[model samples]
Target: MISSPPKLREGLEVIRGMDDIPLIFDPVSGHYHRITRSAEALLGYLDGTRTRDDLVAYFSENARVDQARADAFSRQLDTFLAGLERSGLLEGSEQTEQGTGASPSAGGKRFRTSMLMPRVVLTRSLPTVLEPVARVLRALPARLIVVLATLGAVTGYAFGFHTLFTGTPGLRDLAGPAFLIATGVMLLIVLAHESAHALVAQYLKVPIRGLGVALLFYFMPVAYVDRTDAYRLRGRGGRVLLAMAGVLSDGWFCGVVGLVALNSSGLVQHTAAFLLGMQMFLLIVNLNPLMPSDGYTAVEAAAGLTNMRGRAFTLLRHTIRRQPLPEHLARFGTGARRWHVTYALASVAYGCFLAYAMFHTIPLSVDLALSVVGR
Candidate 1:
């Protein structure tokens, strides 16, 4: 479970979206909120000291929203706080004077400490030869053509997928070399994916923070583009575009590899087929909606779900613990009700799926090695 900083007050600390939504913060007993822009401006006055009336007056003077409007917004804000409280995102009894003092526990910052430099390596401007490739992606139709050509090459290797003991070296005998060469091609395709993402970020005028490789497990190095700057885009569309760029590239690469392998003949063609198939498998697996992979981001972008997954998970656990409900029990809806339910269910399901895969998906050889041998 994701725990909030203990020092920070319970309730919505910040409401993030295009429209100004209320991000409530209930200290202890009293619930406070900032719905309208005027109310948000008054947050500066909360130096852990101001009274409610003082805060209200400050809002009226500095950011003038009529008293009635402000009052209405405040009430809605209170309602939101109450919901959060019931949902266990807020603490303390109602009617209690929430303190304006420092919290008892000033929790330290939570950081994922790593010896490795946390940088993604695709953001550096592409090499001259790669620039044309990026430009061509801007035209997706032509891009599809290139992908088909690659797939054709991959498919061309299939010599009828038969295993024969003839004088001629057959497809099965060549599987080893085929896998290695195919892996190399797939790696290039992976690079293409990273390049697309970086290029898109550059095109959008977003600065590439850095690029670096991540050690997947131990030996595998996954390329990454650090485009956190793209998150600052005002609209959901831009964010979605940046996120999808990689997946789009992967999909295109898969298509191209498949086409090439299926259309060719002989050992090289067979190798291409195997390699293309492997790439497609990787694409599908990586795009599994459960994990924080390309597919996960794509789903988040398409659904316009910003923190909806987090909130849903929070709510689902709360309901499970408090309601004593069975797995099949129907859940009640709240704000963004449908999306909340979907997001929560998906999050939980995906979480469980990932846990299962991590523990149980080891290779047979690894399991054999771990077993104690009794002679």
Candidate 2:
């Protein structure tokens, strides 16, 4: 969310007789100006259907500005609108036509305008097949996680887990193609996860809002489904499936890659190993249930929490109140209470790790591999 725009600098000339063009009047200091043509196009979008938050997002994506900049612009726009109202120039209807009375027409509805983007929540609603998937997830015996972990270990070993030492030559050779493939494959896996969520939501007759790259964390973009409307849904189980869909998709990918790793050879072996390792990383990291990742959403849904952050805070607040009171609360408290702390710390660590990987590890590793392969 962004604050309202600072009042425009004093004495800025108000462009009069530009009612056809979207214009703003700042009565606080008696200044007015025509909104840019692009801004006019944006104001034309005030259909009373799209939320201000959505408009802010449209600006952010279409304008290619960072969220903060977009938000600031939104606030500025709001100030402009407020100014128009103060000048007795606004008709309450966002649309301005020649000679339309500044007073709202009987049919005109006042718009609640502001430049605020709703927090992008990471929850999605489920479809008909979600129940089956949930059943699979619930019945995923401990043996499955162990088996998956062991498979991951095997693939990790194959993909140069031992390259921490005597440098696997083939592993080094796998870097470029591996980088390209791994990145592409990981993207595909994410797409599949999003598709599962969306298709299931569609199956259940939920309107899919839209899909786009979400900044899941700083420097990490993941596809997100806007399933907040699902909160208004009926059954708890369906909601749970929506939340768990992505992680289940990750597990499914891990299973498939694990099977391939057990059967392939040469470059296929390398590819399989890379994919298996990648899936394992996603499964483990994403399933941590700490941050706003897929697993966290699952945990939130399962715990009957309104939101992950809210759940964490409630648990923490209760824990603080119950100090020296009960064993159960303390024991279960970490899972709930410590969640926000864990998420914050983990995010910081993950960010640092990413920075290191990009600046130090990736360059050194890729350069060495390219050098070796070139040799």
Candidate 3:
């Protein structure tokens, strides 16, 4: 073993919980770690005076790690140290003895949709900075808010379903300046969607870290609020509510717009109709449980796992490679595996659905393009 002391990066904030597992935040990377008790204790051994062997001996004894598990424990520790080095969280960067081959099902080789779409933060602590608004919203009755949101969502869906079933022969009407107005409204709805997430999280006393717009595949602008810190909620219910808030906001927005579409005339009616189309698209796509959007995050929160999607992908990877189930999968039990497998199936189905949607959805937007090209 390499004999060098590992020092944690300075100014790191660690939030210790009732479960003894602490959540460590690295401001530099904007990453949070929910580390086990042993892992939390291991950080203390990073003093410059301690050696690798000493650190291993200390954790191994405290962990009561048996002979069969000692090797695995050492490999994990070595890997964690390596990760810390990579993140610039360690003062000294030294290679460990073992390769620390992480389990694929345990987020070793997990993939992310964010890899396709990168984000840039415009503001941090946006909710805190807008504390006066949060305070006003907090005083409002939760039951009333939930009731209105639920009613709006139901009305939005009912109106939308009727439109879809009745056929949109009015697509030709959408090929006009009204489309431009609708596009602008749709953009505002995106911001409102993110705002809803922030408001709900703030009301729940879950700190909102930041809000920003990201380039989706370098073109489509996607707005997001950083309510990720809410994952540490002791109960999944709060996290689920937070996750669903954006979608709920879309429902209310579309419901209001749909009513205008029904009651208005001429240019106003056409613009409202155009927005209604976009809103339905948002509802269908965002509410999809398979996408990496709010619905998927809600599923993750409900399951109480931060790496739910990654773990699901890992299961698929192991199955394709014909490898034995990873050690972590063993804890899920048979019933859990059934749901995991179902999720895997849903994920695959979504991939196919997206392929079809893109094929059709692209041409649907061609009118907007032709308008630009003609000019």
Candidate 4:
């Protein structure tokens, strides 16, 4: 029962999102909270000049509600304001008794980190360095770039694959120096892919926290840029573009290399063809929706959902066990329930298909490698 009018802390930014949804960003915590439209309206009145009773009276007058209904509304408003206070969005308010402070979500953790995917941050100043490039990209015709890149990728891959299976050099011919050259090119492609994500995020005014390298699953090395702040973006379009930027850059690289492979001969042709194949393989992995890849992120952004994979898998587990739905899930609307179940089943099926493909492809790949290395 705070008698004083609760004021929002200084430096909090409220951005309007899709469908007029409001998102409040707290720079200190580097987290953003999605709030309802009504909540946003209520926030406007909390300028340290109005108390809880004043809000209730305002609501009563506006809605033409009786005293009984107004009392109920007052209680609801209290709860909402209390939540905001706990989230550290209110000025001069302490967190809960536990002293752990409020978090961005119910999970109570801002970041998902694991030892299996350890990252070494390369630099925190990428935004400043990449600002000029981002501005240039923003100034260009985005639709034209997308169209050209898409068309080039399709044409180059068609010709490249034709050359690959028809009359290109054998694995023996592509060994040693050609192989090393292709590997170097593949590494550069990976760097460009990550840089594209960062650049798009910067263009959208999302904070680039860091650029880094990480060992995914404790083995596979990957370049990653921390664009988690993209979640704070107001529009779904910006978020989806940020997610797909890496894939687009990969397509552009493949397009260039694939065309080169189609026209060239000797070592250059072999190396470019090899690099194209490697890029295609990486694209497949990146675009697998069953995993937490770029494709999954894009889907989540498009649907304006969060933690879809986690929710889907949880629902799948409960269904398999014939157990009751968890409290949070039980609250889902009809459409959401169906979506979660469908995604879960689809993920399961896709995973099986991948396992089957790998089972058959691994032996062939090993044989190809052995032949190439002169074993």
Candidate 5:
């Protein structure tokens, strides 16, 4: 047995969820790999150990894997080891067989760091001043936030939306310095929007990995904060708050700007109308539950289920095929299965809306861009 700790690639981020699912992020590949608890324990043994046989023997003897599955794993342990090596997580491998170590139950789920758009960090991860902000926020009652957010939402729907769309700004409003100032303000608002998520997450004691802008689809730049650790928070409400933070921030900002725009006159009114419309549009977009946006995360929290959409889709497939649910799918409780089924139906309708929105928005964005440049 060449029992030496295998070389682990650097710059990989390891995170553990409250469910103990291990998420390994490869910065170089911009991919996140989620491995099961058994896989995690096996990988833990790879600390500078170069031999696969020793780890296999150790796993066979002392691993906390399910007893029913132990004999099966023992039979195919070598293939599992090989799968780990093929993932490029380890620097070197003594085994050459490909797709090794990929147990059906323990296999990794790979996500390319995003869902709708490709993300490349405009700035690398760094420390944030959000800790102090979180501290201040934590000192306040959670009830206060909920009340304020509810009130703001009610107010926005009642009056803010009307002001946002009633007085339409012409393309001329977006032609010159007026548009530039609005863009700058919107950027600042976006930064604040992402920071709100970070702050709420910090208040919940979730580690903030970093915040940066990413060029969404290689065109428009979007700001985002790494609040992936929010999953580690045990309280479902905490996770929901973290997910809803940015949406609440947008709502509040839009309400404030809309009220101000309504009270003022002349160019201030026109420009503010334009800004408020854009922000309101963004707020609605972020709150779309069918997308992988804040609304989706909040729904997941409410349902106390991670990967709700995936499970929902799986349930749909099984129902269509008239087959027994897979063992992994059986892990979901009765209530969770019901929720997944409901979400699945809503998702199909929302997905169709999203498709139409994307197709229609592209031409509008091009025309808007040309109008700004052409003028």
Candidate 6:
């Protein structure tokens, strides 16, 4: 056995999560590890002063186990420490020495792109630059302003809906320039939507590392802001807010565009109306709970569950196969099991519905694209 005790790396922050779960955040790698209470206590003992034998003795005394059990525990402890070292949680791990892990900016801030989801970084210091705006948004006056804007947006939507469905312009009138202009404006709205998430993260003291644009799922072009530091937030409320901020911004923009369409005429009205429709469509898409959208993120945060979709699907698969629950899931309480099963059923049903909708909507979308380009 090694003579030296393992030392946890510096700059690691341990925070208590929901249900008093211990969450360790590594700032260098931007990774969070959820550990059990026993593991957390073990981490405290790894202060570099105590040797491996000392830790084994400590565990033996505290757990009140015999020599055989203590020996087994020492082997388990070695395995655990090895895993931690590989994860860069240890002071002298290969990852720490090589400066490698999930952190893309460890070398330098450059464009990190992938064919699956290509993205370009627009800024890396958004928190410092947007500090003034974040401050204003967190103030009481900003809340009042938001309230007023919401009211106006609702009024605009009401009138705009009536005008649009009744005796307003047709799609042909919105063809060519109007449609192109509205599409450009909608892209800007997407930027604003992502900015809202970053702003809220900054307000909650989460670091905003990078802000830019990306093709989500390699097809849907969208703005993206790096709010990965949100895992450090201890409160569910902050996490939910950070997730829903973009959706709220989308709704607000939809309302504003509706209001503009309601009061305008000719080309301007046509553009606004088209923009409103686009925003509303995207808002619905983002609110889909079956997908990894803002709505899904909010639900996961509120439930205090990580990777809910994956877990739910796994549980569903096991149930369908009539297999026993996996070891990890078998440890879940009755409430958690119920939640996983229920969410799995709902997600499957919603996914089927979406597939059906897409089958019918594809032709319509193609025609719409053709019409917009005046084909």
Clashes of each: 31, 1, 0, 0, 15, 0
Clashes of 6: 0
lDDT of 3 at 282: 82
lDDT of 5 by residue, 171-271 (tens): 45543444556777888888888878877877777655656655433444567776655656666777888888888777777777778677876666766
lDDT of 3 by residue, 162-206 (tens): 653353337675546678888998988898888888888788776
Lowest-scoring 10 consecutive residues by lDDT in candidate 2?
Answer: 109-118
Best by lDDT: 4
- The digit string of per-residue lDDT tens for model 4 on 1-375 reads 767888999888887754456878776665666677888888888898888888889889999998899989988788778778877788997633211112222222333444235666766777888899888877889877667756765675566566676646766566555666888888888988888888888888875787777765554567777765675676787788788888877766766776687788987998886887787788887888876679988888898876677678778788789999855577789888888889888876866676677678777667656766677
- Cα error of candidate 5 at position 218, Å: 4.4
Better of 2 and 6 by lDDT: 6
Note the Cα lDDT for every prediction shown. 0.49, 0.51, 0.68, 0.73, 0.64, 0.71
**Model 5 / residue 182 / CA error / Å:** 3.1
Which of the predicted structures, 4 or 5, would earn the higher lDDT when compared with the native? 4
Regions of candidate 3 where Cα sits further than 4 Å from its true position? 16-21, 56-88, 94-113, 123-125, 141-144, 159-169, 173-175, 217-221, 312-356, 359-363, 368-375
TM-score of each: 0.53, 0.47, 0.74, 0.73, 0.64, 0.76
Q: Rank by TM-score, descending?
A: 6, 3, 4, 5, 1, 2
| Models ranked on lDDT | 4, 6, 3, 5, 2, 1
Give the alpha carbon lDDT tens digit for every residue of 1-375 in model 1.
112211223343544332334344342322233245654544444444554454445555766788797886566444433433343443342333221111111121221112122322333444344556556655676446446644543443232222111122443344454556676777777777777777766655554444556543232356665554443445666666677677666655555555555556666765666555555556665676654456666677666544434445556676657755322123444555566667677755765665566567465324433431411
Query: Residue 370 of model 3: what lDDT?
Result: 72
Residue runs of model 1 more than 4 Å from their true location after superposition: 1-53, 60-174, 212-224, 263-267, 317-342, 351-375
C-alpha lDDT of residue 197 in model 2: 67
Worst 10 residues of 3 by lDDT: 98-107
RMSD of each: 11.0, 18.8, 6.3, 5.5, 7.7, 5.0
